[model samples]
Every structure is written in C-alpha cells, then in structure tokens.
Target: MTYRAAIVGTGGIAASHIAALRGRSDVTAAAAIDVADDRVHEFARNWEIPRTFTSLTDALASEDIDVIHLCTPPATHLPLAREALAGGVHVLLEKPPALSLAEHHELISAVDSSTATASVIFQHRFGSGATALRQLASTGKLGKPTVTTCDTQWYRDDAYYAVPWHGTWAAEGGGPTMGHGIHQFDLMLSVLGRWEQVSSMTARRTRPVETEDISAAVVRFASGALATVVNSVVSPRQESRLRFDFEFATIELVHLYGYDDSAWTFTPAPGHEELAETWGDLLTGRPSGHAAQFDDYYRALAAGRVPEVSARNALHTLEFAAAIYASAAQNRAVSCTELTSSSAVWRSMNPGRTARAAASA
Candidate 1:
C-alpha cells in the first residue's frame, strides 16, 4: 500500500527528507505543515503537495496521513512526537530525538504503547562506508574492535546562529555536541556496540550562546573498547571522518561536506586472511544514502516489521548523549545505566529551567 506522509517543518533539513521521499512509488508528500506561512506555501508548491496546514494539531486531526515526519528543532521534538504517536501516525523523527535522557525514555514509552512506528533520522547509518564498517564489525572481522574515534570538525559561522533558537540551551538543546556532533556519536555507538561509561567536557570557544560550541568525550564500550569523540562548530572548515582499530585489522573512513559513495582502507595487522575476506565481502554492495533509509522504513511499515532505526534503538544513542553531558557537568565519569535511570537530571535540563537560563544569558 502507498504511504501518505506529511512533513511538519520546512527548515533546511526538511528539504533532505523531501528529496528522499520524491521518487518512492510507495510514498508521496501528502501534506506540508509549518508555522511560517511562506515556508509552508513555498515547500508545498515546490514539492507539488496538495495541502498545507499551519500547525501540527490541525494536520494530525486529518485522517489522510499515515506517516508524520518531525523535522522541527531539538527543543520541540518530545511533545510533537508524543502527539503524533497518540494520533496513531508513524513518525520519522529527526536527529537528537529529545533534549535529555528522561525525555527519550518517556518518548520510547509513548511509542511502545501506541500502534505507531517511531524512527530517528541517523542518515549516516545508511551511507556505504558506515554500512560496510558495521557489517565488518558485526562479523568479527575487526577482531575484537578495541578502539574507535570520531571527528566532526564542522564550521558554523556567526550567521548560522542568527536564528532566535539557534544556540540556546532551551531551544537548541546544546551546541554542536547535541545539534551536529550527535550524528557521528550515534554512528560511533552503532559500530562499536554499546557504551558503558562516558566522561566529557564542553566549552564555549566561539559561540556566545549558553550551550557549548566545542566538546570532547572519552567513551568505554561494554566490550571493553575505547572510543573518543571530538565535536566542534567553529573549526574554520568542515571535515568529517571515523577510524577503527582492532587486534588484527584497522579501518579508516574519511568524508567531508556530507555522505556520498566513498571508499575506505581496510588494513589487516598481519596473517589475518579471514579478516581481509570479510572486508572484501562488505565492500561488494552498492552505496546507499537517505533514499536507502527511507526505502527500509517503507518496507518495514508494509511488512508490519519494526524499523531498524526505531525510537527504542535511538534511545540508546540519546542515553549516551545525556551521559556525556552529565559527565561534563559533574566533572566525573557517568555510567549509561545511571544516566538512563535517573529522571531528575533530565528534569533539570528541561525547558522549565533551561528557559529561564536562556532568558538571562
């Protein structure tokens, strides 16, 4: 059956969703909704959407939509996600699903009790290099993956933060750490299995907002692997990459600007023929991007199977994020289990408190 999808935001990232949905014969942009009237009209006209709504409540009340894509900012996700789940519409949530761990848990509970499917947008997981890396790691070709590193040195100028909600703690959650760095963090977690503990530090190097513009973290995985993440929004230019080290092999993934079909170097330490063969097997498939992710989501919806990028899957990533921030705030290593179980920490970071800080800062 064809899926009727409605896009809720018309910002820059929403265009990526629109492009991914364009050619799918199983889905169409049934409607568009945004607070900005011009954005709503322009996107609807450009994408050939037949209808547009001024708000999410009005759109969710309509009976035609089968899938709802939440492309709104970080601060606005939880309430809208809960609303869509209540409306019995499948959700394609954008990155940094919520501001804190408790919100992520609450949203997961909402999705679990509802009949709707909820998935987050970690588009990098669909890229060829990343997909290949995950496959090799899963097959034990990496030989007990011991170390992983992620570098997200991207530039966002003063103009980029000109928007009212761009860099504030209340509206945007955190700086590059949560807004941009979360992507590679999610990808790192995807490849290395699961994080057990994290210690992080965030700084306001360039941006004047209350949230940090630069941050770094050291993560320990459940399997005893070490991982490091470097996130920044004032790097002068954009550069993105990841590298993994194992007992018998090493792999390097380097890309810039955005995800594209790219090549990676798989180096065996020595006398590991099986590891080399495993890498060879992984590289045989064609590269994929946003289109592949959407295709997978659509297929899952059709077969009544849970999507791989489901909200529950994303909650782990969100838990890792909250642990990092809490470690930075408390100046100590934080356990993922503790971070996920404590709801008070998340309550402090909610808009109720963060909103006051943003107003004063």
Candidate 2:
C-alpha cells in the first residue's frame, strides 16, 4: 500500500524530505504545505508534488495525506505534530523535536491518545555503521564502552544567524547544542544507551545571538562509560566525530552531515583481530540520511510496530540536551530524573534567562 505524504514548511529541509519520500516505493509525496503560498507552490513544482497548501490544516482537510513531514523550526514542532497526529496522520518531525521537555511531554500525550504515531528525524541512527555499533555494543562483542568523545564542530558565520529563526532560544531552540550537534550525540546515545548524568558549560563566544555559540559537556552513562561532548558553530576547521573505546576494540566515525561505511574505522585490540571481519560484514549497507530513516519508518508502519526514533524514543536525546543546558546554568552535574514538570529547565532549556527575566519584572 502506497501511503500519501504531505511536506510541511517548505524551507530548505523540505527538499530533503521530499527527496526521501520520492525514493520510497510505498510512499508518495502528494502535497506541500507552507505559510508562504508562492514558496509552497514553487517547492511543489520543483519536487513534482501534486498538491500544495498554505497550511497543514488545509492540506489535512483537502488531501488524503497519510503522513506529514514537519520540516519547520524547533518552536513550531509540538503544535504542528499535535495537529497532524490528531487527524490520525503520522508525523515525522525534524530534530530537537520540541523546544523543551514540557512541550515534548505534550507531544507524547498527544501520540498516546491518537491512533497515529510520531517520530523525530535523528537520521544518524539509521546508518549501517551506527546500527552495527549498537548491535556489537549490546551483544557484548565490543566488550563494554569505556571512553568516548562526540564532537560537532562546524562553522556557521554571523550571516547564517541573520535568518530570523536561526540562533534564538525561542525559535531555533539552543544554538549548536540543540540544532547542530544533536545528530551526532543522539547517535552516540543510541549506541551507548542511557546517560546517567551530565556536567556542561556553554558560552556565547563570537556570534551575536541569544543562544550560546558553543557548548561542552562531560556525560556519564549508566554502564559507567564516560563521554565528552562538544557542540560548536565557531570552529574554522569543521568535522563531525565520534569515537568509542571498548575493551576489545576501538571504533570511530568521522564525517560531516551524513556518513557511509567508509566514514567508520574499527581497530581491534590484540588477540581480537576477528572482530574486524564482523564489523566489515555489519557495516555494508546504506549511508546515514533521511532516505534510510524513511525506508525504516515505512517498514515499521507495515509491521504494526513503533518506528525507531519515535517521540518517546527521541525524548531521551532531547532530555540529554536539556540536561546539558541545566548543568551549564546551575553549575553542577544534573541527573536525568531532575528535569521533572516542576523543573525550570523542563519549561525552557535556558532557565537562567527565564529566572533573570522574572527577577527584573
């Protein structure tokens, strides 16, 4: 059965969504929705989408859209997803699924009540290398992750933030930590499992934006593995890197944006040379990107199961991001359990700013 899909928020990312949908045999890119009528029509024309609407409501009302891909800003994710889910349409949201844990919870509640499912786009986890790493780590083949480092060091100049929603806490969420490095760290979390605590620091070094231009964190996982995470938009030399050191082998991935099997390297420790063959066999599939994720999502729908990176599954990564902010703000290590409904970080990732605003008022 071919599912009809509507692409919402026809910005630059919508093109990726459309392309992914087009690549799928069981899905059709039926409609494009955006607030700007001209832009939406242009996007539809460029992508050969048959329908266009100025809003998701109009698209839902007119087109028989089975799923809606929300490629909008961070602040708009929850409401748009709620609307699509309410109409019994599956929702595939862009990264940083919601602005805060509070908003993410609302999305979770909406998904719980509706027949439809919602997934966040953490495309890195769908890669063959990441999948192989996850399987190896889970099956004790990697011999326990000991030390790790995840870094997203990409350069985005001042002009990049000149876009209205590019670097604001209210719109894009929180600079590189929320918008950029999330892909790498989310993939890290996927392979490493639950994170226990986070201690972090954030700074607005160069960019004249409301959010931090860089963030660094020390994360401890439940398995007693220690990891360092760095997110930056100010680096001149750009790279996305993740390295995992296990007792039996050392695995590393170095790439920007997306990764194929070539981006990964596995070094087996002495007496474990056979693990190289296992890694080679496991990492022989598609690259990490929207197309791979969309393929898996459709398969989940066909199997009557929740898709990978579902709203619930994605919450851990979102909470980990929030914990970084909370730790930076409070100047202490933060536990995941601390970000409850009553916590200020739950309402806004930048709780320090919220507190200062309240004090002045």
Candidate 3:
C-alpha cells in the first residue's frame, strides 16, 4: 500500500520536504496543514497538493493523512506530535525534537503507548559521509578516535531574530547550539557513540536575543575521547566543520549546511598512508540533507520496521545538548545520567531563569 503524508506548518523547511516527496512512488503528499491560511494555501497551490487544512484536527478529522511532517516551532513539537500519534498517524519532526530532554521523554511515552511511530529530522546522519565514517569506525580503519572538533559558526543578523520564535529560549529552545549547531554536532555524536560528561559555557555576546549567541563546550565521550564543540552566530565568514583525530589518520569535513565526498579530506599519519585510497572509495556523491533522510524514512515505512532517526536515537543528541546547558547553568560538569526526569534543566533550557530557580523559589 502506498503511504500518505500531510505536510504540517508551511514554513521555509516545509518546502524542502515537499520537494523531496514530489515523485516518490512509496509515499504520497496527501495534504498540507498550517495555522496560517494564506501560507498554507499558497504552499498547496504551488506544490499542487490535493488537499489543505488550517488545523491538524481538521486534516486528521477528514482521514486524509497517514503521516505528519512537523515543521512548526520547537515549542509546539511535543503536543502536536503526541496528538498525531494518538490519532494513529506517524510523525516526522524537524530538528531539536523537543525543548528539553523531559519533553522528549513525553513524546517517547506517546510513541510507546500508541501504534504509530515517530522520528526526528537528524538528516545529517543519513548522508554518505556519515555512512562511510560509521563503517571506518566499526572496521577499525579509523582506529580509536582521540579527539573530535565540531564548529558551527554562522552569522544571523538582527532581522533574523524578528521572527517571534527565532531567538527566545522558550520558543527556539536555546541559541546556536540548540538551533543551528545541532545538525553538525548531532553528526559528531553519530560518529562517536555515547558521551560521558560535558563542561560548557554560554554567553549572549552580540545578538540581542534571549538566548546565547556564542557558546563553547568540552565533551568527553564514553570511548575516552575528547571533543571540543563550538557554536556561534557572530562569525562574519561561516563554516560547519568536524574533525576526528583517530590513531592512524585524521579525517575532516568542511562545508556549510551540507556536504558530500568532496567536502571531506583524510590525512594519514606516518607509515600508515594507504588509507587515503580506502577513504576515497567509501565516500558518496550525494550530499546529505532532508532528501537523503526521506529516502530512508520511506523505505522503513514500506517495510514493517520503524524509521531511522528514531525517538531514542534523537534523545542522545538532545541529552547531549541538555548536558551542555545544565553544566553551564550550574557552573559544573554534567553527566548524561544527571539529566533525568527530576532534573531542573530538563524542564526548561533557559539559562537566565532555569527550571532550578523556579523550583527552588
């Protein structure tokens, strides 16, 4: 049976998914849903979507959708996703699955209790570059990763924050770390498995937003490797870069937004130089993005298995970000184990007035 999907929240991101799903034989663009009438209808007319509704309730009520693509703001992800699963519809949420780990757990509960499945848009993980790295790591070709560096430095102007939800912790969750750097760092975590602890510092350097525009962290992975993570929106020249220092060679990827094989470079250490040929053969031509992940998502739905980028997988990245914020706020190193249901930061990501402050008062 061909699967049907409804595009929710007709924003800039929704256009990417619509374009990706245009000619897929396994999934159909069943309808479009958004609270904004003009934007939703315009999206529908442009994409030639057969149906459109201004509310999820109305679209679900009509029984015209099997999947929901949530491109709405971060604050609304949990409720809308839970509602969709409750109605027996699958959900594909955009990045930053939830505002906090606590909210993410609730969505996990929703998926657990319902027959429907849900996934997050950690699209970078689905790329050829990611696949090649995973193989190298597993095969011991990359050896033990000694250090990893992830830097997401891009400029967002004052006008970018004009959107009511763009900069607020309550809406966007956090700053560059939670919003922009997430994709790059999520890929970092994908390459290096679990994180042991994180020491971080966040500051609102220049952007007149509620959240920090500049932040840095030192993360220790479970594999005894160290990683330095930097997220910033103050850079004049932007780049998304990640580097892994393994025993035999150092692998680095440099690109903005997306990358293919050409964006990656490998340098071998002394006496172990033949790995360059092996690495070149492993890289793929297709750059990673929404389209790459959509291919995997549709394939999973076609089979009986749950999709890639599952809620649990997405939680690792979310928990990692939470650790950074919690560590920065509490002025100490934070372990993954500390971010539990009872944790203060789990309830909110705001640094100025944390959940701890509210609970203590």
Maximum-TM-score candidate: 2
Q: Which of the numbered candidates is closest to the native, going by highest lDDT?
A: 2
Candidate 1: segments with Cα more than 4 A from true spot:
284-288, 340-344, 348-361
Predicted candidate 1 versus true structure: per-residue lDDT over 25-118, tens digit per residue: 9998999999999989999999899999988899877648899889999788889888889988899989878877677888889998899988
Looking at model 1, report the run of 10 residues with the lowest lDDT sum: 343-352
Residue lDDT tens for model 3, 1-361: 7888999999999999999887888888989999999999999999999898998988999966789999999999999999999988999999899998889999999999889899999888877878888888889877889999999999999999999999898888999989999998999999999999999999998888999898899999999999999999999999999999999999899999888878888899988788888877887777898989998998888786899798987999998888888888889999989888777677887645664476699
> Candidate 1 overall Cα lDDT vs. reference?
0.81
Clashing pairs in 3: none
Candidate 2 similarity to native, TM-score: 0.98
Q: Could you give the candidate ranking by lDDT, starting with the highest? A: 2, 3, 1
TM values, all candidates: 0.93, 0.98, 0.97
TM-score ranking, high to low: 2, 3, 1
